[model samples]
Target chain A: MAKRPLILVTNDDGITAPGIRTLISIMNTIGDVVVVAPDSPQSAMGHAITINAILHVEKVTIDDGPQTEYSCSGTPADCVKLGVREILDRKPDLCVSGINHGSNSSVNVIYSGTMSAALEAGIESIPAIGFSLLDYNWNANFEHCKSFVKTIAENVIKNGLPKDVVLNVNIPNITKNEIKGIKVCRQARANWEEKFDKRTNPMGRDYFWLTGEFVNMDKGEDTDEYALANHYISVVPVQFDLTAHHAIQQLNTWEFNS
Target chain B: MAKRPLILVTNDDGITAPGIRTLISIMNTIGDVVVVAPDSPQSAMGHAITINAILHVEKVTIDDGPQTEYSCSGTPADCVKLGVREILDRKPDLCVSGINHGSNSSVNVIYSGTMSAALEAGIESIPAIGFSLLDYNWNANFEHCKSFVKTIAENVIKNGLPKDVVLNVNIPNITKNEIKGIKVCRQARANWEEKFDKRTNPMGRDYFWLTGEFVNMDKGEDTDEYALANHYISVVPVQFDLTAHHAIQQLNTWEFNS
Candidate 1:
């Protein structure tokens, strides 16, 4: 018999979140599974690592499953690092993050701890994917996403991703039958127009809650936003090489004499 | 005389760091300055926002200067959002983050609080730059960086960056006369080889410190790592559009039938 592929599973919604529980089950069917994820919710953490403090990890059995799980006191990115470096004796064949409780589409990718975990794995030269649903509810229907997730993950392991590339997969909050097939897309041009909710504490100290309106400025139909709106799962191949190579020549034209 | 441009200065090293103070001094010479940075050090914060908790901003004077300063209880990205939406009456002519205590070159750009601020500004369509010195000391000499910082800021104000692009500038720790000129470069292919220092706490629980060896895998002469090592200030224009456009066609061949 062929050796079972080793799979590392993680999410930003914490180790016990239903989203990851579903992901763990899906991975167990495909390969040997090991989960290393944050002990508490770490949404919107981006690519942060725990440098200022020590991180604690506890091995636990959350459910009756073939997969072994470890809860971590660190950001999503840190979980991937610890899993790859400390927990596993060898590099996992693949790393999958999320079934995130909400969308990591468009500019949201910049604020996504879910995607950050996958990006961290990608930086370590592992084929990785971050899966998210358009729904924000914890009990949102991840059952509908099971087959699609498995197929994508299986394909990634078989064909392999481009070097330094990871997948940002966002499924629309729709039933499996209602969903159209997956579409390869680009990230949409979008931003948050911040609206601070200012208030004074009883002790008279002023504070503000960070809230914002997401404004999508792109009209391109090939974007992740467009795919999601059309009820198709969007798979944007994401890269960590942030260099805007096209802009270099123009920047070079500018005078920088000191 | 025409109105002097409004310049927003910030950093991950906190409001009292010598790095931002030097940045503020340089911006003061070029335009009207406003410093809105984190109240405490927030290095490696990435693109995190304070959505889970309240944020506080206090207007104050750290030193005798014409520039207005505000200390913010948030990440470097939060400082930029608050500065643009609540503090500044108008969009800043240019937003500059850091003269960071350490390098944000190569793959460090993904985990940099300094670059996150600059990227936040870029998302808002504000021309932005994040500056860093290679030294990691709190008292790293920044005098040698003044002229280069000023030159870059002036050029950015004159030649607006491409849409969705921000500058990641990393300066080598050398005297002005010893330094070579600036180089427009690409982000080097590199990553941390994590060495988790596992230990037992006083309470007898195992914890780990996230430490690493930075290994540069790219041999490209045009990379930021190459430029920095050669005593040149490295300026890599970075984009928040994480889409690996080149790989989109390849991903389209994936089987993701619903």
Candidate 2:
């Protein structure tokens, strides 16, 4: 028998999110799937790895599927660590994270629990990808994402992802038919124009809730933001290293003592 | 009166740690310092922020210094968010994070709370930096870091950090005199080989404590890893965008069928 591709599956929206279920269904069609993910929501956790506490992962049967699954008591990155280092008998052929319920484009990638899981796998030298939809709603339509997800996954399985690089795929929230072709792009020059909602607590103490308006500063039509707006599925290959190579030379020109 | 440079101070080791205390002491000499830091340790948190929970900022007196310090219940990113959004009366002239108890060079930058705080500030278009020492011990030597820290801070103040970039400065564990000059470098291509120590609880439940070995894959001497190894302070300018621009063109070559 031909060896089936062993695909490791995980997400930030927890084990029960429809997004992962959609991701799982796609993986099953392509490979022998093993799923490990957070049992509860871990959105916006970025790259948090559980170090201050102990992590517990218990096998759970969520759907009637051929895939073996485990639910973890940690962040999304924690699930990737548990999946590769403990759960899987050997390194999987590929690791795919998130048909995430929200966008991981532009600066959102830094705060994405979805991409963090994928970056964790990339750090472990595994080919990895993170998939997200521009929609943030839990009930956002994911059926349209199936083909793109499969196509991307198959491509990764066929042509290995670059070392230390992971894919950040953000699908436009429109219907599958309305979606244009996929566009490989760069992250947008964007940021949240944060407006803190200050309120008084029950104890009459001031507190704040993080709220913001999405501000796209880049007018370039080449970025992920532009691609998504043009209705294309934006695929940005992201690496874990946060270094700004250009600025290093600028720092070098400065005399530290002067 | 000459305007005092507005220095925003933060750290991943929490506002109370000696590392930040030492940093605060030094910043008092150069500028008007205002600290917005986490009340508890946020080590290894990466770029995580408080989204689901309400954020509370409580002003506290750590020690008598020129800086006014406030402790907040959030991750390192949140500290920067609060610092820029609410704490500071105006945009900071420069933002500085850490003097963290350990290294945040190479692959650690991706998983570092200290560096993430700096990156957060950079994202907000603020001149920013993150500093750390080679020692992970709580009582790690800070005396040696003085000259390097002062120099880097002064350089940033004088020349202003470039757009969309922050600096990750790693000092050797040796005394300030034994420390060689600073080197502007790239993040070493490296990662932690995760070794989870799985154990059974008293209830016979399985739990894992994340552990790892720092593995360097990049052989280039132009990296933070190599510079730190050679007893020089490594300054790796960092940014939030993780997009691999070189790989974008490569992934575009992949045939994706609808």
Q: Which candidate is the best by TM-score?
A: 1
Instruction: Report interface Cα RMSD per prediction.
Output: 0.8, 1.2
lDDT of 2 by residue, B25-105 (tens): 888989999999999999989889888999999999988787899999999999999989998889999889998999998
- In the range B89-208, model 1's lDDT, one tens digit per residue, is 999999999989999999999999999999999999999999999999998999999999888888888878888899999999998998889999999999999999999999999999
lDDT of 1 at A137: 96
Predictions in order: lDDT: 0.94, 0.89
For candidate 2, what is the interface RMSD? 1.2
Q: After superposition on all CA atoms, how large is the RMSD of candidate 2? A: 1.4
Clashing pairs in 2: B144-B176
- Candidate 1's docking class is high
